[model samples]
Target chain A: MTDVLTAAPDVAEIGRGVLVAVLLAFVAFGAIPVVAGLAQFLLIPMHAVRNHYRETGPYLPNVAVLVPAWNEAAVLTASVDRLMALDYPPDRLRVFVVDDASTDETPAVMASLGERFPGRVVHLRREKGGEGKAHTLNHGLREILADDWMEALLIMDADVIYAPDSLRKMTRHLADPTVGAVTAYIREGSEDAHGLTRFIGFDYLAAQAASRRAQNVAGAMACLAGGAQLHSRENLEAIGGQIDTSSLAEDTVTTFRTQLAGRRVVFEPHARVLAEEPAGIDALWKQRLRWARGNVQITSMYRHLWFRKSVHPGLGGFFFGVFWFAILLLPVAMLLTSIGLVGLYLLDSDLAATVFGAAVFVPVATFVFMITMTISVDPRVGLKVWKEALLFPGVVSFAVLTGATFPMLVPWGGGDSSGWTLFVYSWLVLCVPAAFLVRKLELTRWGHRLAPLGLYLVGFGPMMCAITVDAYVKEYRGAAMTWDKTEKTGRVSV
Target chain B: MSRGRTTTDRATAAIVRSLAARPYRISSPVVLTAAELAARGGVLPVWADPMALADETEADRLRERRLVAGLVVAIAVVVLLWTVRSLLM
Candidate 1:
């Protein structure tokens, strides 16, 4: 009986050791995103040394601009005007507006544009429309390709305003035969910018100006901006001469195909394209949900290609795979980290506190590094959206980070505060659901007034994570793919 | 000192001359005088101008330097904060 009692203690000790190890594993797994994000931000500076501009030349090809219009009369005329004003060889550029059976004044606008710029702007109407952007683009692609006059095809949304020099900058990369495709840096250009729009501006600065530069250095692009992706005729033919219509993310599929087919897809950061983003949280959620779901679809579709260098070097390598999954599986990682931290707290509060104290500095450093680097990329936008950038992780998380950074400042008495510690540990998991609640709040009349405040408090990062979680749920349920078009009010100014 | 050359044209000519290494020339017919090009249904090829391209390249290089400088500043700030925290602790 004494031996059995002694053995019980030993067994309990072993179980405790195993639990601690498992919790540590979870915490470590959660750190992957923070580490990966920091690595990506760090790579942005490397673009100064390693970039694709050395091979670029002043190569101006006969470019055909394809615009797929669906009830876009409000913005179509302005978009076409901007295209007409591009600083390219006027004779070399032709605008093809594929009118997808518009219920608005798109037909009249196109007719007027056609008359105003005869032989330059041609309108191709689709009697049967509303399939998706890919189908509409394919229609124009067919017509553009049929006439052997086009050397390169520029696929753009109906609402985007290309900078006068954006096309030339993009075409410069195509000067190198190895570069089959090029995407421009898309900026959020809302004339009367609100808090949400400002947040979007900062988001674009991080995603495009900062992240795409790193992608260029790494030689693996995630996706071509739908607003401004330029493709060589040869590349178009190589990738089956049409955009992939099977997935919501046709742009991503096309980008993946271009890379997989041994052709280089370049990101021209200097080529700035201004796009109108969704101004409302609900609208943004729906738009991002489509993109998020598309990413999920892409993850599964290209399951075989990841981490296999024989498939392709950059896209199949470990760095690219980690970066890709780090974003796609962020919510899962957050959940695991929260569960582990909370579980540890329940078992051993002191040990949990120690682990969290040490670990919190990583995210603090990363956030600082990432925000500074991102703002520096485009100081003009950054200056305007600095508040949004600072609150990007949400106000509460930012507070947590700040407190973690300077523990002396926080009035926790440097004593036992289990309640506060538990809240901090659980915040990671709670933030996602809180972000979803913010969206629901926007639907209520009075709550709509407070939604912006809620967004600021919860943070855009958590909201995006929430959207990603929604994408997973919808995808798992086999939800019908609906093309939810964001309403454009011609608010984008050059 | 061409008869029809404006002050802008003269400046462009001087800039072109300064670039003796590449010896800039308006080789494309798209770079013809605006009126002449407009008569042929072509727009002025401002993008093809050698001097403009060079200026853009210089600007891009400057931006890259700025990015690197910003990164250095960020790292320095982070290190300073860490040092202060360590000292305090």
Candidate 2:
């Protein structure tokens, strides 16, 4: 009986040790995103050395501009006018607007544009519309591909305005025979900029200006920007001659297919295209949810391709997989890290302190490095959205980071047993839900006044995490995949 | 009599002069002359010097190198501050 009693304590101790080990593993899993993000950002500098410009030439081909329109009367006129005024050869450059049976003034506007620009602007009307962007694009692609005149096809959104030199810049990449497609940087060009637009501006700068540069260095791209993707004739036909309509991310599907077919996709940062983004939180949420869901779909669709070098080196490599999943599964990582930290604090305060104290510096250093490098990529946009950049991880999380980094400045008692430490540990788990609440508040009567403040407090990163969580839930539930188009007001200024 | 310089030749000369002047200073290895541009039936934009584009890429490379150096220095300073604080504590 005495031996059993003594053994009970030993067994309990062993169980406790096992739990601590498991929790620590969770914490380590959480650090994957932070480390992966830093690695990707570090790769951005390597683009200076490993770029495709050397292989590029002054290759200008007979380019057909494909504009897929559905109730885009508000922006089509300006968009068509801008296309007509592009610096490329007038005879070579033609605008093909595939009208998806608009009930609005779009048909009338298209007729006027057709008359105004005659042969330059050809209108292909889809009587039976509402099939989505890919179907509409394929409708036009069929016509454009039938005529052998189109040496290269430029697929762009109806609302985006291409810079005068953007087409020439993109075409230069296609000068290389091996290069399949090129994407231009899509800058948020809202004439009346708000906090939401400013946040989007920073997001674009980080995602396109910084991350895409890193992808260029790595010789693998995630997706071609839907607003400005330029494809060679052979590339389009090689990828089965039609955009993949099975997924919400047709651009990504096309990108992956092009790369898999042994052709390179390039990102030309100098080729800037201006796009009007969603100005409201609800609108932004809808758009991002679609993107997040698309990512989830792509993740499953390409399950066979990841981390397999034999299939393809760049896309299937370990680094690319880590980069892809770090963003895709970020929310889950945050939750695991939070749960682990909080559990550790409850189980053994001293050990928890030791682990957190050691782990904190990496994220802090990475955050600083990433922010500085990302801003440096596009200083003009960075200067405007510096506050948003800093507040990306939320004000409260930033406070925690600051305190953790400099314990002397914001002392949380020598031991990590303080309420402040516990709060810090719990904040990661809380932030996502709080972000969802912020979005919910935006739907309320006093939303206009309070939502912006709430968003700032919750931070854009957490809000994105919240949208990702929503994507997961909706995807699991097999919800309706309604194509909620973002209403555009032609607010993009050159 | 020397034939009057066509628009293409003038444009080509202008491009050559611009390349020779000031910062560009480098002679073109592959001159995409305005005759070629006119043959393609496209007028080159005022800023569209194909050779100068290569120079711009080189300039961007330099700028990126400087930025990376700045990043390294900033990271070092952060580490130094953290070390100092840890020691003082």
Second chain TM-score per prediction? 0.47, 0.41
Q: What ranges in model 1 sit over 4 Å off?
A: B1-45
Model 2: per-residue Cα lDDT over A1-494, one tens digit each:
99999899899999999999999999999999999998887788777678777766656678899999999999999999898888765667899999999889999998898899889899999999998899999999999999999989999999999888788778877877677899999989998878889889988988998899999999899999998999999889978899999888889999998887767899988788999999888999999999999999999998977887545668878999999999999999999999999999999988888999999988887787777877877788788888988888888889888888777778554654378888889898899999999988999997767998888888999999999999999889989887889999999989
Cα lDDT tens digits, model 1, B1-89, are 11343453355344334432332112143445668678748843566576677567667766687788779878988898889888977
What are the clashing pairs of model 1? A394-A459
lDDT per residue, candidate 1, A1-494, as tens digits? 99999799899999999999999899999999999999998999898878887777767788999999999999999999999989888888999999988899999999999999999999999999999999999999999999999988899999999989899888877767677799999999999998899889999999999999989989899999987899988789978998999999999999998887667889988888899999999999999999999999999998877776556668877889889999999999999999999999999987887998888878878888888999888888888999999999899998887777787877983688777778889999899999999999999998999999999999999999999999999999999999999999999998
Which CAPRI category fits model 2? incorrect
Error of 1 at A297 (Å): 0.2
Off by over 4 Å in 2: A411-417, B1-70, B73-77, B80-84
In terms of lDDT, the poorest run of 10 residues in model 1 chain A is A304-313
For every model in order, what is the number of clashing pairs? 1, 0
On residues B20-77, what C-alpha lDDT tens digit does candidate 2 reach at each position? 3424112123345678679757855433566666665555446556557646755786
